[model samples]
Target: MLIIALSTNIAMLCLVSAVLQIVLPNDAPQWLIFGNIVVFVACVYYTYKAVTVWPDEEKAATIS
Candidate 1:
């Protein structure tokens, strides 16, 4: 579930970036920079969440 969320977020971010680049003027740096920051923060958040939910295969096998 978390992996799905992470991938979806990243994919959406890329789509947004592409759309913004096509629609926005070349001189506009602010929007692009802001988008980049938001994407970075989202990636960091998802990464942290993913690490927590990730299965510990080694520990599980040992326990079994």
Candidate 2:
């Protein structure tokens, strides 16, 4: 659940960054775009991990 929460939070942050990048003027700092890209990648990774991995309880159930 914590991983799910983190993934959702990261995804939401990425969406915010994307909206800012689109609505903000081009004169916005280049670093902001780079930061957004980094954040987007992080969100993607977190989402993938959250979906593919299991919690302790889940793993124990699977083993039995």
Candidate 3:
């Protein structure tokens, strides 16, 4: 659940960055573009992990 929420938020950030890229002038700073790419990659990784490697609540409960 937490991963889901986090990935969702990251996805939202990626969306916002994409929108900004489209709306803002082409002269956006290099760092901003790099940051957006980094965020997008992170979002993809988290989303993939969430889908493929879900946490086991039973194991989590046992550990706690």
Candidate 4:
């Protein structure tokens, strides 16, 4: 479901960000960090919206 998608997106973003930070030169630009922050924020917003709109039954099923 959407929650899973959002979580995966967040995880991928974090992984990519970490790899970029580790592999990029020490003097590399800050764009990678900024992009990671933006994507993370967007994912969190979408996850909040999905949770708020999800049906009670589905939420319960997810919890269990």
Model 4 C-alpha lDDT per residue in residues 1-64, reported as the tens digit of each score? 8675866689577668856776777765678677776776677777777777777987789989
Per-prediction tally of clashes: 0, 0, 0, 0
Of 1 and 4, which scores higher on TM-score?
A: 4
User: Following a full C-alpha superposition, what root-mean-square deviation does model 4 have from the true structure?
Assistant: 5.6
Q: lDDT of all the models against the reference?
A: 0.71, 0.78, 0.78, 0.72
Q: Sort the candidates on TM-score, descending order.
A: 2, 3, 4, 1
TM-score of model number 4: 0.55
Give the clashing pairs for model 3. none
Candidate 3 worst ten-residue window by lDDT: 28-37
Clashing pairs in 2: none
The predicted structure with the larger lDDT, 1 or 3, is 3
Off by more than 4 A, model 1? 1-28, 62-64
lDDT of 1 by residue, 1-64 (tens): 6675775678578657756766777765767657765775677677777778887999989989
Runs in model 3 deviating more than 4 A are: 55-64
Candidate 1: give its CA RMSD in angstroms: 4.4
TM-score of each: 0.47, 0.63, 0.58, 0.55
The window of 10 residues in a row where model 4 has the poorest summed lDDT is 27-36
lDDT of 3 at 30: 71
Q: What is the lDDT of residue 59 in candidate 2?
A: 75
Q: What does candidate 3's lDDT look like per residue over 1-64, in tens digits?
A: 7777887788778768877886888877777767877887888788887777875889889999
